[model samples]
Target: MPNATTVTEVGQFLKNPPEGFTVEAFGSEYRVHCSEENLVFIDNFRSGDCDIVFQNSLGRKLKMHNLWEYTRMRKSLLSKRIYVLVSLCDQNIPESSKKEPSEPKVLQKYVLSIDGGNPRIKWQMERGLDWTISSVAGESYRVEIDLSEILESLAAAGVIAENLMKCNPIWKDSSFSLKYYSDALFDFPHWFGFSKRSFKLRLIKNT
Candidate 1:
């Protein structure tokens, strides 16, 4: 089992992302590379397993080709221990998402995940989250995201963007994990603003 590794300090990451790097997101560690730095958009949210990223943000990026490109590159990447994140979308949403779609198709923003479909791998995250919540339920931490919902949204986004500039798709994938790679950092879009992934989420008070 992999240890609970995360680069909380963005500066440290940007400064250095050793070789075998992995970012924790999508209830698991998503892939990242120092070379793809500028290409990846970074951001954070109150609720998500992405050390310090929003679950939704990661979810949306699941619809992009850059992500798949990463998939195609998986073998060349961490070929030693690989678990590619692949999504077999059902293009037909069956019915328009009752979820009122996402923010908007900026023809830009949309972008973001499942790690390995393995249930055990999921528990790894659950345990980590459990410990996080128990240790700091009142303090701070990221939360699990509804992947099912995001995928539904992506299937509706139409095909993905092969050419980055071709269509922009939704937006961009928010960089979240890794450390054993080289020199990368936790960054966010200045335009969108950043929030602590540990910030306590405003839970709905049960009436």
Candidate 2:
């Protein structure tokens, strides 16, 4: 029978990622990267397992053609050291979803890699950013990222949001997770701030 892993064990491994690495693990989940110096920690509260988490101040670039182009610029500026953390839940995918399921004891995880559906790969390669991947797995896997390169890519894309601009924030608690989302859909303009630009909008009453 296949072995089962817990979040606590995963946390232990990430507590110390390595010299050029930073790690975090807890609740049967963890993330590690020696070259990128990045780690992720997650605890599953649901009935099933949680996948990886890709944590970064810069979220997805709004207008990129693909993930590759986005990754290229990100690696170039972040000194070729990038950290991407992802977390997953065991939600049901309907039969119409066109995705496959893992067997009873297996799970599939796709990290923030060039081929992992990065929307900008081709454009990035044309821009001259060189990147290679290395994968390691034990109780878990260690994926490498070049931070400098990633930062640079964000700047070039002009999609890096100011609020999440920090390279990495000081997380106060030993076991905590960060999540991002918008209350409204893409087309609906929600009230995020009351800045000058937003205040100029006109309000009208219908008859």
Candidate 3:
């Protein structure tokens, strides 16, 4: 059993989770437990698999799973006054390849934001300055884009690229924070083609 205040705190923490905090799935629900604070309990219970017994510092315990109930719970929390903040971490492409390839490979990188509750992209980079097109006719041209390759690289790095492709505007208007690339971007060799970039998004509150 999680109270409204506790649930709101949990959501806030998830928005900008502190270092060392971890999330794990327990049975059919998700649990965010912090060993440092000795807190552990289910946060979402919509699967109706609630035969669990978990406790936390707040002194609330639960053992049931109902999707509708969970939805109501989340709505109850969202109905309260809250602030949302979106943050983007710095991304840097390494100059040296981990392995050599027979042919030259063009590698592009991207930083994107996905919905924590769903598979959607709140924001992402559309194209790089290097992107170009070759005109073939008066009204026709061959568009050359590296977005696909860049997305593939991000996916390989464990990002949810498929969901990011949806390009949802749900997060529009939300305050955003970013960590700009530091001097590390120029430390690599010039031929390595190192590039630095940023991504943006906005989040809105129900209230």
TM-score of each: 0.21, 0.24, 0.19
lDDT of 1 by residue, 178-202 (tens): 2111111332321233212221111
Ranking by TM-score: 2, 1, 3
Off by over 4 Å in 2: 1-20, 28-48, 62-79, 82-107, 112-207
**Cα lDDT of model 1 overall?**
0.30
What is the lDDT of every predicted structure here? 0.30, 0.29, 0.28
Regions more than 4 Å wrong, model 1: 21-60, 64-119, 123-207
Candidate 2 local lDDT, 67-146, one digit each (tens): 45345544453333222332222333346653676322212121222221122433343232232211111011111222
lDDT of 3 at 131: 31
Q: Which pairs of residues have clashing backbones in candidate 3?
A: 46-67, 48-65, 50-64, 50-65, 171-202, 174-202, 174-203
Model with the higher lDDT, candidate 2 or 3:
2
Per-prediction tally of clashes = 31, 52, 7
Which prediction has more favorable TM-score, 1 or 2?
A: 2
